[model samples]
Target: MTSASPTRAPGPFSRFEWLVAGRYLRARRRDAFISVISALTMIGIALGVATLIVVMSVMNGFRDELLGKILGLNGHFTGFPIEEVFHDYEAVRDRLEGVDGVIAATAFVEGQALVTSQYASSGVNIRGMSIGDIEKLPLLYSSVLYGGWDDWDNLEGVAIGSRLAGQLGLGIGDPITIVTPNGPQTPFGSTPQIRSYPVNAIFDVGMVEFDSLFVYMPIRAAQVYFRLYEDRLRDGVAQPDLMASDEEIDAAYERVYTATAVEVFVADPDATARMQLPLEQATGRPMVFTDWKQRNQTFFSALQVERVVMFTILSMIVLVAAFNIISSLVMLVKDKSSDIAVLRTMGATRSSIMRIFCITGTAIGFIGTIAGFVLGVVLALNAEAIRAWVSNTLGIALFPPEVFLLSSLPSRVDPVEVSVVLVMALALSFLATLYPAWRAAQYDPVEALRYE
Candidate 1:
């Protein structure tokens, strides 16, 4: 009569496929001891990944912040004439602007002078720049805290940094005298002269060293105050007798006879060498050029080392969690020997047996790692909020400006870093599955069933 209905074949991963393997992992939860150990392992992986992300982001943020501050206060690159004064700075500037990666170029005179206030005095590096050109360097404009640089007219006025103003107890429109090394000559003899300049404005650059040690002045004022000019040497001759006043003569001689040096400010902060080449070649004098990175090598180097050390130390947590995975899987193998033997009798291949346990172990690691990554990124992204919350709730300051230079916590989560950490977590988890999977695969059906 009709053909017998073909028996339905069991699908891959049917009840029989998972039952033996599922029992091995479920048994862990049934035993309070195994359950605690497994939970701790997951916690360890989560904490490890979270800590690594947060710490790495913080370090990266600090590095970026520091670089910004440095580059802002100091131009990306500086070039100087090989000779004391660049006779053909216009030509040199033009040539530099034509260089590859060169953005803009400006010439400046850099010198050291004594800055004095009513109550205090400190030595500062005076930079002579054109107001129009200086404006191109946005850092200078943004850093102006108390007064505007526009006030630096052809008049004898100067812009001091915020730190310098505070240390000197000076403020906007304060009268601070700048005494630069000058020379005066008269019929009697020649002597050094000093000139005074009123503090016109103050800028807060947030960098202590630069803020405390730098002042900007109009090019002519600096040339006059420091007497850096060629008028004192008329017709290539040293004229000590051109004294209207002894003070005038000495200052003029100092300005004219002394060589003039030009400090070139470039647009591209990284092309220190490229910009320097033309200036040195054109001037026929030895000029030194330096970039922002080279200027702050020590600080950046320390930060880099700290980042590596912190990452290395924190990874131990992940390693310990991996050991937990190993221990859990090993125990599962021992407890599931009879089940593994039964599966073997049912025609489940050894490779299939291995796959089951491997999947189980990997699942544990994947869950913990994914959870940790999500939580870590969330925490990192909202670090500022977390800091604020902690401060308000606990009544404790997290990052004090006086101590940290920044008033708030900094964070910068990188996608690449997160991906690497996730992959590493999964790899460690997969590694933990090996020995146990192998042990389960080696089980002999006859021997396993003989005992039962």
Candidate 2:
């Protein structure tokens, strides 16, 4: 070994290369300008990543929150008759129960009417639903904060939305009148049907659209109001019995009351599309099936488009930071030309010289990405609190339910999306190092140290 030293092993880049790379990254007072530029580059990358994470997470949160409220109130799939009321709804509902992916199937009647209290009047959508169904639905059950479900089916009882109650100056036990557009046709003219019912319950679904514009009535009451009576009655006409048996009239009433639609809830809404054909086949009737996605396509599409546009615009921040990385590395190479030349003269290869600068630049990106990730996660986790603090301090309301349709700001982070951002930042920063690193490697040792 003394006579002839064993050949040294070779690697792509050795320990010596890493040491030099780390040393160059360390801030030195003599290179104050370069050091400051390097720090700014890192800060720039960090801020960019943080902004992207926060914005993307907020958008995701908004979509999920809106979908939950809408879907919780409106089932995943609904089957409505083409034009006629579904007179054979029981048979249809029974058939639907056999369909795959059907969680719960029930009959529902929907209609539009003008509702008035002593204080105000407004047009609202009235849905006729069974009290048993209401009890089974967690959204409806949990929302009934004021009254119990015992009196929901009493022909004189109704459930109104909290916002609707407030607007009409009505509360539990207050009398509210519903007037439907259709009524019994008389010889002179048609008159709208009016019925007064006490507000048995108040529900708040936390959605402005539903809260301000919907009310619920017993299915039997809705049938009478909408005039879904037996075919024995003449067109939009009601006949009182003079000598006919009450049992015959009651049997006729039972035969006619039917649902306008059948609402179907599924275990997984995303897979509801697969249930469409099966459900239609099971119904064996000409029916229209509308999924939640189809019903709210425009709104969801707009949200997705806005999210993409915001991401593209914000990614420019990271791109700008990448350019800063390029500038700093270029300056660093120029400042250390003599040192690189010295290493080259001492048997260091050109590739090793390139790797040194690459490591230095990537370190900045790596550390910056980690810092931004942590900061963003923390901020998103405490978004509501931060929103409240900012709102209180600024004397303003950031999310007024009446205006924005949501009670507060929402934020949700997807780990996959976060990982993508991290990888993107690192990739951009690594690419930024290439040109400067190659230039440093190509310098002539003699020229670099000619006048040193």
Candidate 3:
């Protein structure tokens, strides 16, 4: 028995591991039909990945751009009362200032009026603000395309939006008549008066609607012009016949003067409700607070829905490519059945047989996914260049400046999004290999050898 000991053989890997895997890939190349199918599958995955990346990045860029436009034009939150006027505005401002998240507090008068120039007339929204308070708002400071807030401080002058100026055919230092409801005691009786203001400067915020409708002036000037404190007497009541006295006029005026409103700016745009609570308590008015999100909810919601729909549609391509992988693997199992049986007879484990096919399928997915990711990043980073190339080559604009807010294509490739996409592609590829690999591993050595 001691003399009959036999030498142990080396493992199968040392004998034929590299050769087996290399031969499988090479054999695939030699089969023209299989090679074509594999090539198509690779192309499909690449196209799918590339499209998904470009589309998602573009959507992200668009979302950022749209949000910037909205936030820049409008502040995060605006706190105002349900009533036409709020009394004790100073108290309201004090309460808001004491709040944790409030950035700034300012008082403003808002009303509708008709603006008339010698050559034209246009209806506009009159916004009255203190020049000092206006400067505190960062959006206004940054958006000052022309002129400064100082222009509003001057009593005789008003600042008009650039587009409004264009529409009215007016410029700086031009005289414009503003007709507001101002109650003045004339020789006959108290009647509504109209005042004229000189346009001192023009500002353009790059937003067409704001430019066309907004006109800013000093708060005091607006209060004086509109005569907010003037009271409307009861119908059929005569001043002398009813024996109305100065005390009554003074009391009525006091009623109007006591009403005031404060607008607070919050640090976090999303804290509108929190900021409103303090203002509502101080003013004793029903406070209505609005944020940018609520203001443009429809637009932002549409963008999100579009993104999801686009991603789902593009994912179908990857699904189709995965199916192609399944087809390739099934064909591969048939081609390798004889070799699988020979290896089994040599005591190769079923798990190793399955692993070989799994590795092959995973290699294909990995290669295609990586290639697509690289290509997508390159295209996304150079989207403007690609857009220009397409435009120049086709002699047509890919993204028309008039149609889109941005003149060129925009893209922002987020690393996290790219990582998720790559992981999904790899997972799909791995899943595609499982069934075929399992089938290959279940091959019977005797039956496979008999057929060979």
Q: Return the top candidate by lDDT.
A: 2
Q: Residue by residue across 99-156, what tens digits does model 1's lDDT show?
A: 6656666667678878887799999898887686577677777777776876565667
Clashing pairs in 2: none
Candidate 2: C-alpha lDDT: 0.85
Error of 1 at 9 (Å): 12
The number of clashing residue pairs in model 1 is 12
lDDT of each: 0.73, 0.85, 0.73
Model 3 RMSD vs true structure: 6.5
Candidate 2 residue-wise lDDT at 62? 84
TM-score of each: 0.78, 0.90, 0.73
CA lDDT of 400 in candidate 1?
A: 65
lDDT of 3 by residue, 81-183 (tens): 6755565565666666777777777777778888998788898988777777677666555665555666566675788877788888987778888875546
Which 10-residue span in candidate 1 carries the lowest summed lDDT? 254-263
What would the per-residue lDDT of candidate 2 be over residues 200-248, giving only the tens digit for each residue? 9898877888888988888888877887766555445456577768865
By TM-score, the candidates rank as 2, 1, 3
Winner of 1 and 2 under TM-score? 2
